[model samples]
Target chain A: MTLAVLDGGTYYHQEAIYGERLGGRFDRTIYAPELTAADLAGCDALMVADRIHPGVLRGKRPILLDYLVGGGTLIVLGENSAQQWAPGVSWEFRPTNFWWWLEQGGDPGHRIVAPDHELFRHVGMKELVWHYHGLLTPPPGATSLVDITPDGDPQGKGGSILYDHCHVGGGAGRMIVTTLDPFYHHGSFFMPAASRFLGKLLDWTDEAFRTPG
Target chain B: MIDAILLDCEQSETGAQALITDLALGPRIDLVPFYDLERTVLSRTRALLLGLHSDQRYLASRRGQLEAFLGGGGTIVVCGHIGHPFLAELSPFQPIHGYRVDDLVVNREADHPVWAGVDPADLSKRRGVAGFYGRGSNPPPPGARIINSLGPSRCPVDFDCRPAVGGRLLVHAGADLWGYFGSGNSSERIMPQLFDWIAKPSEAA
Candidate 1:
C-alpha cells in the first residue's frame, strides 16, 4: 500500500515514513507546510505525526477532510489537538508517564480491548508499555480496540489508546487515530518494541485497505 | 523588563510552551522568536532562554547580537546542544553511542548554586521514564564548571561557562529547564535555582 506520512521537520517523522521501505509498505513523507490536495493522489493511507504545529495543520484541513470523506484511510499519530486539526476527535489532558517500561514489572497501563482484532494479530500488549502522546476521545460509534488500565497509569485513570476507528462522511471513508507515536520513538530513538509494533500496525492498515468496506 | 525571553521553539510537547503557561508568564512568547530578537528588544531583558529545540539556524547566524546582549550583562541560558558556532569555547555535541536511561548516570563534577541540594536522579526521570534530562554531550569549555553528566560521556549534561565577556552562558543538554517547575518532582527545584542565579548571583551563592 502507498502510505503518505507528513513531516514537520523532525528526525522521527522522517524515519516513520521514509526510514525503511519494507513489506510492500512504501511510505512517503508529505512535507507539512507544502502538503496540498494534489499531494494526496494515489495514496491509500495518510499518516500525520504528533508534533506538527496546529496552525500549519489548520491550513491543510480542507485537503485532509477531502481525503477522509472519500474512502481514504487517515491515521493521526501523536498529539494533534481535537479542537483544532483532528476531525471527529476531542483530546483529554493526561500527565504523561514515559518511563513505565523502565520499571520492574511496570505496566504501561494500556490494554488491547479487541484481542482478536487484526491489529493484535502481530503485536501484543507487552510492546505497548512505552509511551503515548495524549488521551483521545473519538466520536460516537468508534470502536476502541484498546484502552488504558488505571493500574498501569500514574494518573490512575489511564487515557484511551491502542487503536480507534470511525467511519466519516456518511460512511464513505474511515479514520483511525492513535496516541502511539511508534514512528517517532522508533525513528528518532531507535526503540525496538516501538519499531516492531509500528511495522505490525502499518501492515494491518494495509490488510484492512484491501478488504471491502 | 522581561524576566526571560525563551527563543522560538515548538511549544506543544517540548515543554517550552508549557513553561509559559505553567509559570504564569503569558504573551512573552511573542517577543523572542528569533525574528523579534533585536538589540532594543533584548537590552532590558534579564535572561534569554534557548531550549534544546531552539531555532539554532536563525540564532546561530546572529551570534553578534547575542554577544552584544551578553556584553550588556544579560544572562543567556541555553538548554541543550546547538547546531551553530554560537559558543566558541564549548564543543559540538557528540551523540552517545549506546544511550540508555539506565546507562545515564548523572554525575556532578562541579558545584553551582543552581544545584545546591538538587539531586541528579531526580532530574533523570519524568513521569516514570528516564533520560529526557540529557541525551548528548557538550565538550567542557575552558573554566566551564560541569554540573551533570550521563554515564562516562563526560560530555557535560549541565554546565556553566563564564566567557571573558563578563556574561553568563549556562547550558543544559536536555529538555527545557523551566518545564520542570510543574513536573511535581524534586527537579522542580531547578526553576528557582536557575531564576535566582540569573536574577541575583549573590543570592545564588
Candidate 2:
C-alpha cells in the first residue's frame, strides 16, 4: 500500500505537512512539476494535496488519468480546481463563510451522508466541520460521503463535500474527492480540526489501500 | 521599473486569488510563478512579495540571490507563518495560545505610510470575527523596528528589518497584506499604499 503525495514545494507542504509532520507516513513525495508516468508507477494510492497549482497538475492530466485507468487509487484534495482537469467532475466555487462559527448557535452545516462507510470509521463528522472552499458534483454512480446544506437542515438540498467514485469507465481503480482543505490548514498550523482530520484520513487511506475491495 | 515582483504560487483561496488578480492590474508589478524565482532576475526589482503559499525551502536554497537582491536595497515583504527557516533573520512563527478577540487586536507602534490610512480596529477583525489579520508573531530580529503589535502583550505582528547592509524587510505574521482587500474599510488601502511606499525608495525605513 504505497502512498505517494504530490508535493507543490510550498512552505506549508514542504516544511510543515509532508516534510516534517507526516513525512514518515508517505512513501514518496513526488514534486508536482517533475511528475511523470514513472513517478506514478508502483504507487497504490496517490494524493493530490490541496492548493497545488492547477497549472502544474493540468499538464500531467494524461499521466494521472493513465494511473487511474491502470488501477491506482486517486485522492484529490480541496481547492485544487479538479473540474478543470479531472474527467466527469463538476466543481462550483462557493464563497467560504469564515465567520459561520461566530454566529449564535452557528454550524458549518457539514453532514455525513455515509456514516456507515469505512472512511467514517476513521474520521467522524466533527472533524470535517471547518469551512469549505467549494462543492463537488461527482459523476454518476459515485457515492457521496459528506455534504453541506446551506439551511443547516439535514434533509435540505445540499452539495457534496466528500465523495467516492469507482472508475467504471475503464478501470478497477477509484477516486476520493473532498472539498475540505485539511492539508492547507493543518500544514499552516492554524486549524486543529484539520490536523485531527488529516491524521485520521491518512490512517484511513493507508488501511483502505491495504485491504483493497 | 517594476515596483515589486510577487511570487505567485496560485494559492486556491478565493481571497488570495482575488488579491493576485487585483495586484496584477497594477502597471508596475510583475507576478512570477514561485518555481521561477531561481531564474527570475531581481537586480532591478524594487521588492519581492512572498505570500503565505511561498515555497520556503526553495527560497532557503536561493538564499544567496535573495541576500544579494536585498543588499542592493531591495524590499522584501513576507506574509504568513514562518514554518521553515528561509532567511536567517526570520524565526519560526509562534502561535498565540488561548487567544481572545482582544489578543488579536493590532496596535500601531509607529506612524508610517503603510499604516497611514488603515485603521487598527479595521485590521483586527472582518465582519465581527477576529484573528483574520494575524494569529501569531514571527518575532522580529534585533535592530528591527516594530510597526504593529498584537493586543496588550504587543507580540510583533508587523515589523521592518534591515537584514543586510542595505536590505529592507516588512514581515507580517498573517496572510498577505492584500488579504485585507474587499474588507469595506480603510484597511483596503494597505496593498496599494504598500506598493506606493516601496516605489518611494527615499522613504525606506
Candidate 3:
C-alpha cells in the first residue's frame, strides 16, 4: 500500500527520516507539500505532521475528514498544529509550556505499558522517558494506550503518551500526541526509546489499514 | 468562589512555588501532583493556576482540559516556559521557532489589565532579571492584548489575555519571576497584583 505524507514545510527532516526508516514496510511513500483530495487517489494511508489541518484541507479539495470517512488511515502529529488543524478530533492543547525545563532536567520516572495492545507487540512495558516537547489530551471516544504517572500517584492521567485507533465515520485513524520530538532528526539519537516507539506506531498504522473495518 | 488553584505539575512547579509563595498570593494553591492530575484538576473548582515547565507530557494532557475548563469561564494562570505542540490545537496562537529569553529588553505595551497596579519602570526592571525562552509565532487570538513585552524579540513576557475558547487566561514567561517566587522575599510586592488579576469576584459583571 502507498503512504502519502502531507508536507507543510515544518518538520520535513523528521518525515524524510521516517520515510527512510519505514521504506521496506511501505510499498511507496509520497511527500505532497500541497495536498489536495486528488493527491490521495491511490494512497492506502496518509501521515501529516504539523502542517496540514482540517480547515486547510476542507472545501472541494479532498479534505482530511473526508479522507478518514472514506476509509484511509490518517496520523497527525505536532502538539500545537494538531490542535489548530484538527478540531473535530476532540483533543485539547494544555497551555503549560515547559519544554526547556524537561530538557534541562525534569524526570517523571515512570514505566508505560500497552502490554496486550497491537502497537506494543515489539515494545512491551518499558521505562518511558520524558524528552519531547509536549503531549495531546485524548478525545473522549478514543482509547488510551499509555498514561502518565509522576511520583507514585495512582492516577495515570497526567501525561498521556499514546492513543489508539479512533474511528470517525467510515474511516479509522490513530493519533499519537507525544512530547517526544520523534520528527526531529536528532530525536532518534536523543531518545532511542521514541524512535523505537515510532517504528512500532508506523507498523501498527500499516496493520490497521490492512485490517477489515 | 475561586476555591482551589490548579498548578501544572512539572519542574516549573518548583520554580512557580518560589514565585507565588514569595509574592504571598495565598489562595490555598494545590499543585496537581504529576501522578494524580485527573483527580485533582477535574474537581468542582472555580479557578485554576497553571505553572508550566518544559515537560511535554504535562502540556499534552493538561492543554485540552484547561481549555474546556476555561471555555466554561474558569480562571487560569499560565507561567514559566511557553509553547508546546498541543498549543496550536487548543488556542489560536501558533508556536513559532527561535525566540528566547535573552532577546527581550523592554516592555512596549503599557496599558493592559494584568499590569494594572505595576509601574512600567518596575516591569522594565524585570526584563533583565526575567527571561523567556519561547516566542509565540502566531498572533494572540483576536481579542487578546499584550500587557508586557521584551521589545527586541517582540516576545511577550507577560500578558492579560483571553483565549478564543472564552476563558480568563494569564501568561507569563519571565524566568526571574519564578526565581523570585521560589526565593520567597518580595511575594508581598508581586503576588497580590497577580491574584487581583487572576482571582476575579464571582459576582462581577
Q: Against the unseen true structure, what C-alpha lDDT does each candidate score?
A: 0.66, 0.80, 0.48
Q: Number of the top candidate by DockQ?
A: 2
User: Which portions of model 3 miss their true places by more than 4 Å?
Assistant: A10-15, A18-32, A50-62, A87-114, A124-128, A150-159, A169-180, A185-189, A205-213, B1-205
| lDDT leaderboard ranking | 2, 1, 3
Per-prediction DockQ: 0.14, 0.51, 0.02
Per-residue lDDT of candidate 3, residues A1-213 (tens digit):
576655422222333343444444444344332456777776777666432222333322347666766766666654334544453444433333334233424544334555676766655544244343345566766666666554322233465555655664424544444444344322212234555655665566667554433
Candidate 1: residue A27 lDDT (0-100): 52
Worst ten-residue run, lDDT, model 2 chain B? B11-20
Chain B, per-candidate TM-score: 0.85, 0.93, 0.66
Where does model 3 sit among the CAPRI classes?
incorrect
CA shift of B27, model 2, Å: 2.5
Better structure of 1 and 3 per TM-score: 1
- Full-model lDDT, candidate 3: 0.48
Clashes per candidate (backbone, < 3 Å): 3, 0, 31
Write the number of the candidate with greater DockQ, choosing between 1 and 2.
2
Worst ten in a row by lDDT for model 1 chain A: A18-27
**For residues B56-149, what per-residue lDDT tens digits would candidate 2 score against the true structure?**
7667888888888888888889988786778878998777776887888999998888889788989887787777788779988888888999
Q: What is the lDDT of candidate 1?
A: 0.66
